[model samples]
Target: MKNWIIIFIVSALVGFGAGYFIFQDKEEADGTNQTTTQEKESKQENVVKEESKDSNAPKTATTSDGGIFSEKGCISCHSVSALNIQGGATGPDLSKAYDNVEGKHGKPIKEFLKVPTSAVMSGVIEGNPLTDEEIEKIVEALKKAAEK
Candidate 1:
């Protein structure tokens, strides 16, 4: 009877130990999965919020000619102080670009707008060439801003 009791106690301890380790491993796995799921949810929410905010924002710059500079993503690089517009400062302030293109570059603004041969502009316009109408409107807008 004594030997039987000892064997039963040993079996119970082994079972309990195995169950504890197995439960702990399962719990850890579930915790990792929950953390991963929460991270993914947070990222998705941020994306949705950004999209919503962008959709409600203005699509064009506040230029005289109603040029859609932001539509072409120019606002990501340049800013026009005359228009009271603030944008990324990666490129130059374009409030005086019209004057520079004509006076310094010694080329018609329209010609520069069409080809954009300058080092800084060529790369920006290469992949996304503007339409003649867009160039004309934007040039007019820039000219108006330069006058201010």
Candidate 2:
């Protein structure tokens, strides 16, 4: 009877020690996972904030020959930071239009002004093709904006 009692106590101690170690390991792994998740979330939030700051930055100097753009109602659908103008969001930002127009189109911006290719732009300028002088002035303004 005495020997049996001693053996039962020893088994119970072994079981308790094994359970303690297993549970401790699981708790440590859970803490590590939680920390990793928090770090990732923090990095994502920082990236979003940086992007937001860039988009919302204040406009700088106005475009040199912005009058032609304004006269042609280009200001109605385009935003040019160099021109310090914030138009509607309907059209792509003209601040970087020179790069796309001159590089991708492989033609002078004046030609595009005479006959815009995009459907949305075609509708906007359907009956209002810019004159030679107007196109020149607008091109000059866009080039200036792009340089900055």
Q: Ten-residue segment with the worst summed lDDT in candidate 2?
A: 56-65
C-alpha RMSD by candidate, in order: 18.0, 20.5
What digit string (tens of lDDT, one per residue) describes model 2 on residues 1-148?
A: 9999999999999999999999876664455434563564466445434544676754322344475655566655677876676555787789888778857565667777777766666655664567788778888888888998
> Scored by CA lDDT, what does every candidate get?
0.69, 0.67
Q: Which stretches of candidate 2 lie over 4 Å from their true place?
A: 1-65, 102-106
In lDDT terms, how accurate is model 1? 0.69
Give per-model TM-scores. 0.55, 0.53
- Candidate achieving the largest lDDT: 1
User: Number of clashing residue pairs in every model?
Assistant: 0, 0
Off by over 4 Å in 1: 1-67
